[model samples]
Target: MSYADVNGLSMYYREHGDAPVTEDNPALVLLHGGLSGSDDFAALVPELSAHRRVITADLQGHSHTADVDRPIRVETIGDDVAALIKHLELGKADVMGYSFGGGAALRCAIQHPDAVRKLIVVSFPFRQDGFFEDVRAQQRQMSPESAAFMKQTPAWELYERTAPRPEDFPQLVGKMGEWLQQPFDYSEEIRGLQVPTQLIFADADMYSMQHICDFWALLGGGQRDAGWDGAARPGAHQLAVLPDTTHYAISSSPALAGTAERFLR
Candidate 1:
């Protein structure tokens, strides 16, 4: 339960695994999804920390971290992660993010590549249009009023219990909805990234298979299958689609944790 003064906010972050993290075993920063908190990664953190120090943080307006005057945007939140890393005095660290956090992770890698050693993006699309038709349709129709139903969910309970202003739930939802409505495309930027990366998603993720292939292709994957000798492999970037999972369940899958562990190592 530590907080770092970053980007004009006291960002909440938790450290795990062996202390006195060193360059040989850099920390692994974990970012939770939208409307979710650092607790979302609790189950996975131990496994991750077994190999290296794991740092989990609440994104703005989630759980222990309160919202600021700025609107909810991945780019800004990503910058916040970079700031936190510097605040903690780590030279660089591997970063893993889930869902909306995945968006922030992508932004951090693009905007602060020098601060990142490896990148892991789970269950999120690079571009706004990359989401499935139904997903985009849902986002388009989402509103603060529509968010009323979420009050019955765990996200609501967590927000009410831990938010700096519990009553701000609706306001947070409203801003998130508004941000999702805007179109975004980071294809070019992702293509230019030099960081080693891993992409994980549910087989039934919000993105279509074609979209995932396109994403892999942009990262120099799917161009051609590796030969028997595995001599023609593309960049170190890799993609994994977890089995029998949806976007909601993918984050909690043991398979995701295993894949991430292997990738980070």
Candidate 2:
């Protein structure tokens, strides 16, 4: 339950395993998806921590962190992360973001390339097209019961809609609405990334499969592969697909950790 002060906001974070502070053993900053806090990486963190220092944080307005006065935006969240890295005096570190956090990580890396050694975006959205519009429309119709369930949904329950429960619908719906209103466009920024990056997508990710594919294409590479081909890129960019996994595989499946470790290594 560590905490850091960034731009007048209190950020809650957790660290696992042991690694030297020197650059020899770089650290990995893990950012969870929207509406979910650091808890989303509870399982994967331990596995990753064995080799590298792992840091996970509850972004402002989520989990133990204090809520922001205004609605959170992706760029603003990115800045918060930047500030945290500076406060810790970490010159540069690897970053892994899931879902909405994936967008935030991209923003952070693009805005502060010097602070990021490598980037890994999981099930990240790169465009703001009709797919997001559909998600927004569906969220607007959530009933009160569903809305209430969403607000207090546990981290694991937030991964899938068919988790055999209807309690967190309202909260999930509200978060989805918020996401729609404040979507990010990092397409141009991502194309210019100088640091090494790895884009991962789960086969069944409800939201960003096509968008992610489109983004990979925009990276100026050869034809895309169907699944985990580990396609090469012009400037250290790589794309991999995780089979038989959903949007929440990072938390729900241990296989994702192995894949990530192999890529990062």
Candidate 3:
């Protein structure tokens, strides 16, 4: 484990693979989901690291990285990641994020465009309203009590084992509840993005198919009929809806690594 003091954060990040740093092949930075740590990407990291250097970090208030007095907003955390990347003496890296981290990754692409080669977001959207009503309803129920209920789960177990402040778990949950209560939209930003990007979601993910298509439309996707020469298909941006997966199980899907690898390639 290595640490970098970026923007007042002693961020924890680990590097995998011995691939040399080069302009054509920047390192990959992987961000874990909410209440999850770097270990959340354990299965997918090795799949990616064999060919490139993969950096995994625990976001602020998760595990390993302690929280600051600041609120946990997507844009703020994205800034933290940009600072961390620059602190490492690198200009940029292809970023992949899951769930909560996915939102931050999207913000990084939005806020720090010059510092990204390619962007991948797994099961994420630009706005809180993109989520299913049931999911939002459940999010409203999050509190210290919910954290207590999840204390016995594997993600919580990992947090207790490695979090910088194990006692702050409930507070983290509350903060997330507050963050989700607010809504935002980044569709315009996505439409203007020049960097090649990929959006991957499970067939049964939290977002509706219509919502996903609406998001994709902003990226110049699903707009016109192809001329059969692959010339007028759509924009460079891509979208993938993995089969036989749900919001909870999508991270573990065998097809995710391969799909993302192809897109990153």
* Per-prediction TM-score to the true structure, in the order listed: 0.97, 0.83, 0.97
Instruction: Please list all clashing residue pairs in model 2, or write none if there are none.
Output: 146-169, 146-170, 147-170, 147-171, 149-167, 149-168, 150-168, 150-171, 150-172, 151-171
Please give the distance, in angstroms, between residue 33's alpha carbon in candidate 3 and its true position after superposition. Answer: 0.9
Question: What are the C-alpha RMSDs, in order, of all predicted structures?
Answer: 1.1, 5.3, 1.1
lDDT of 1 by residue, 19-59 (tens): 56788778999999998898778778878888688899999
lDDT of 3: 0.86
Q: Give the poorly placed runs of model 1, Cα more than 4 Å off.
A: none
Tens-digit per-residue lDDT, 1-265, candidate 3? 8988987888999989999867887989998888788887788888989898888988988899988888889899999888888887667789888999998888988899888889998998777789999999999998876888896798789889998789999988888888888778898888888878889999999998988899888888888876778787555678899999998777778899899899878
Better of 2 and 3 by lDDT: 3
Q: Which ten residues in a row have the lowest lDDT in candidate 3?
A: 226-235
Q: Which portions of model 3 show Cα errors greater than 4 Å?
A: none
lDDT of 1: 0.88
The candidate with the higher TM-score, 1 or 2, is 1
Error of 1 at 165 (Å): 0.9
Which candidate comes out best when scored by lDDT?
1
